[model samples]
Target chain A: MRRLNQLCCALGLFALSAMAYAGPPVEGALEKQATNWHAIIMFCIFVALSMGITYWASSRTKSTSDFYTAGGGITGMQNGLAIAGDYMSAATLLGLTALVYGQGFDGYLYMLSFFAGWPIILFMMAERLRNLGRFTFADITSFRLDQGSVRTMAAISSLTVVCFYLIAQMVGAGQLIKLLFGLDYNIAIVGVGILMMVYVTFGGMVATTWVQIIKACMLLTGGTLAMLLAFSQFGFSFHTLMEKATAVHKLGIKLMTPGSLLADPVNAISLGLGLMFGTAGLPHILMRFFTVGDAKEARKSVLYASGIVAYFFNVIFLMGLCAILVVGTNPDFFEGGTIGGKLIGGGNMVAMHLAKAVGGDMLLGFMAAVAFATILAVVSGLALAGASAISHDLYARVIKKGKATEAAEIRVSRIATIGLGIVAILLGIAFEKQNVAFMVGLAFGVAAAGNFPVLIMSMYWKGLTTRGAIVGGYGGLLSSVAFVVLSKAVWVDVLGNKAAIFPYSQPALFAMPIAFLLIYIFSKSDSSARAKAEIEAFEDQYVRAQTGFGASTASSH
Target chain B: MSSAMYERMRGNPKFQELVATRGRFAWTLSIIVLVLFYGFVMAVAFIPGTLGQPVSEGAMLTVGVAVELFLFIFFWALSALYVKRANGKFDALTAEVIKQAQKGGK
Candidate 1:
């Protein structure tokens, strides 16, 4: 409590003094001097509040179940809020919106793919996932199997997904703080890193969930108010806003139509599949299902989540249009839209730039703060999920021989969270200058490649042996990473040098199918793979643990 | 009633009426929700975007986001209906079926 007071006082002093001392840098130096202090202060408040929640939750947690799954006591509504929080990451909040502002209909394709996944998650995965995996995504994949290789592959995939996701979010945090608070990029990265570590280390999933819930509400409120104000700019008429947006389109700058940006059918379709199925395949997202109590309740949570997400994306779509229309009207919005514009980039500043055009420093500061809060909340979840994969699946199972007590596991988890946080901070600092939009795409691609195939096979195919899962999961992981490294997006767009290495940017077309085929082939190879003996033993341990039934009953299968 | 008639309507008269009424309500509620949500989007697209006037872009985004923000409440309403109907109607029928199944009755 004393620390909290000191932190608040320090922030207040910093905000007042920083604004008085800060001066706008010249065009080239703008990135250095544009840190929005208001945003920084707002972001700190959320981080501090989340830490408070984590401490409270940690105190209440008394057992292994409470530590790992929050005793599965979360109400459906709370889970729904967390689900909203989980889905609306920096990628969806900033990347997609920025893409829409610049590219028009092409950007909507991203939202369409993301939004399309919820119904699929509800209908296909959620209920069964809860029924099968009690604590982690690994539970379902390692079922009735040796779990050694499968757990390793899952850990690798989980780490990769979280790393890329953290990079995107952390970079966004740094950029948002720099833009809104006048802080140095390095300081912003360090600040965000420390906050995320504090939240996950002290609180675990409980702290993580509440922060997500609060951020989700703030995001909804911010997004709605922005859209409403955008409409009011045109007298609350959708037609007028469309007319303004369309007129801007007529100036040979198409922001509302699809073909204007994509230009190729293959790229468009692949990008679409990547976004849609990719959301369901995310380890962080799949982990949220375990936090809920029952299989039946899991179904209810997803139903609500889908509806919320579907509507949320629709509003974001309007905000995207508003970005171009309002910014289109005020040339000042994009004094830097191009080579000579005030802002150098087209994507990151769409939300902030639009807010400035509509309101002023206050609105800009508030939106920027919300964006920062979004990044902090998301990175904390990613770090926590990754920590669980390490401490629970690998450390507890392998090193401790599964005899590690709950207290021991929690200790390991906290240590792992701190380690991951340090890595995230370093990566955020390293990649802060690169285009953040690509980071999101890379995260999705990696997840789709590594984890999705392994998960799908494990749940549906009873014949999927441990060997098949290990090979398929690892194979997907390596192939996707290799493909991404060679792809044009990385070589030419990111590295700014071009040579024909990998013909395709998107590898899901080749990699995902190969992953599925490998799993199928391996699952069918050995007669012993279908051994009824092992199935009975495996069922005795994990399946019954989930059903809340006597563990011994399943031993007879 | 004869055993055949009792089997057709179930052993309990109250259970039959509840199923008929709740089933209708469930279907109607689902359809209404589907239409309302889809209608909201269609209207947003055709009704003139909320983007062009004197309002702040943040406010516009907020309003647009709010439209979807209420999904939690919608879900709460759906869950309430489910619990109410399940407790009021579905559970009773389930109990009757269990009793019949246990008795080895048709």
Candidate 2:
């Protein structure tokens, strides 16, 4: 039956990708162009470098700890860069800039909410997570709670977030490869899946971290260069750039205001809640804490990540503005020479088009390669996190009752990575036309609702029992997914329903509170001996969390 | 590893001071950030028209854009502040408390 199910999934995915390829060519300036050799070469170089890193990492990865945490040898600064790289995917650069090109002030608001998440993570979760966790986030939640149940719940939640996030990245990668390399959607998705699998299965966290670090540096450099070129056009004056942007944009001066994309207050607040808190709950991001040696390094990592991410966002905001003036008004970027016509490869190509306008084909190729690298790096991180949850949390701890050998665990992790990579590719092809940015938001909502509530309660609330955490965690997970399904974004937009049952698209605003309430009520009413024991153990957990007294140390490989 | 060591650390004046000071500092900064961020959200919700208004006569920039920029800088500053204190005073106090606990054990 399981083999049949796997075959069915494979056939379904093939059918989906075939359908997407058979569909009419996307309209606008991006009409079926020849593959850019320059971009392909640059991309090949990047892939070769990353594969070399993977080979090196595989040799060093001998134990479960090494596979999971890179032997906890990463420095604070390097981890910070990797975190920023993991967080600032190509969707952030391209999708966000496109939003700005199309909506102006609304895009800026999104950028702000995204950056706000980092500070909250630094303030609340980073240090404690580093102190408590060893491999996956389950290690932290299972600290004072029932190890079996808590690990199961955490594994489920982690997989949910990872799958959602993975699909979003994969979809973006497909679209990007299609645009840049002129590759078919199916082939692009498969290529990305295969490369990401190789990275995670062979290299594990060490390869993943270095990939992210390299990608982050490339992305930062590309963004900075693009911004500089844009600035040169206006003599490096913000005033002149804004003036030109206002002139070029249809909305004129009003483009600088906040009411363009999000006019509704409730929706805006809900979106804010999702972006801010959802970032804190991300499993892959939390899993990064284990790569560092100590709590201090973890804390420093968040600080550095916040700074680098903030700087990147600010640069992209300006880049997006410059794109409005440069790419939006350029006839070369429009189909049929129509003013305000559909851009090539849609709005997500705005950053790429801007690269072309400012620096021509060579820079455009460089930026495109960097963008592809960005996707590969992020997907590898997500794949690793998901695999760890499956192998470390569920298979090893829950199924084997913590008796699984190190080699067995590592083997399982690699197998899980391959499985996850395939699933992500299929889902990516399936969700190709959906807005990748909004999908990322949905992933955040799920993370915030499901994982964040259980994690926070387990850490701070002594009364939280294993049963309470499970109930709350799953409650958040189900409610978030349900609300999103009922929302206009999914029902009306994606599923073609006439109307949506849920008023808001983002579910975190409602689902998070419900999850918290369930945990509180269940914990308060519980009088079980197990609950009492867990509550009593909270003192020790608190001490360890605060002081890192008995925290896991890095092993010498 | 022992309950006695935990009890000793919890009772120590320096440990108590570290916990109280750090907790209060984190909360204060967090509340400030929440207010600033949520306040901006509220403004965008309730008084969006005001946010749409330009910062100066004939200026292209709006009040909303300017304030968002300021909030971004403020957040970075707050992070730096927290990290500074954490690495300096917090680390010092933590090391001192751990040393005293280990000394007691010896």
Please give, for residues B1-103, the per-residue lDDT of candidate 1 as tens digits.
Answer: 2233334334445444544664565556655554544443343344324311213553322233344335434534564465455444554555564355345
In candidate 2, residue A459 scores what lDDT?
76
TM-score of only chain B in every candidate structure: 0.59, 0.95
User: Worst lDDT window (10 residues) for model 1 chain B?
Assistant: B46-55
DockQ per model, Cα: 0.05, 0.66
Error of 1 at A119 (Å): 0.7
Q: What is the interface RMSD of candidate 2, in Å?
A: 1.3
Model 1, span A160-216: residue lDDT tens:
888888888888787766655666677778777877877777667777888888888
In candidate 2, the residue pairs with backbone N, CA or C atoms under 3 Å apart (3 or more residues apart, or in different chains) clash, namely A30-A344
| Alpha-carbon shift of residue A427 in model 1 (angstroms) | 1.7
Q: What C-alpha RMSD separates each model from the true structure?
A: 8.7, 4.6
Q: What is the Å distance of residue A321 in model 1 from its true position? A: 1.5
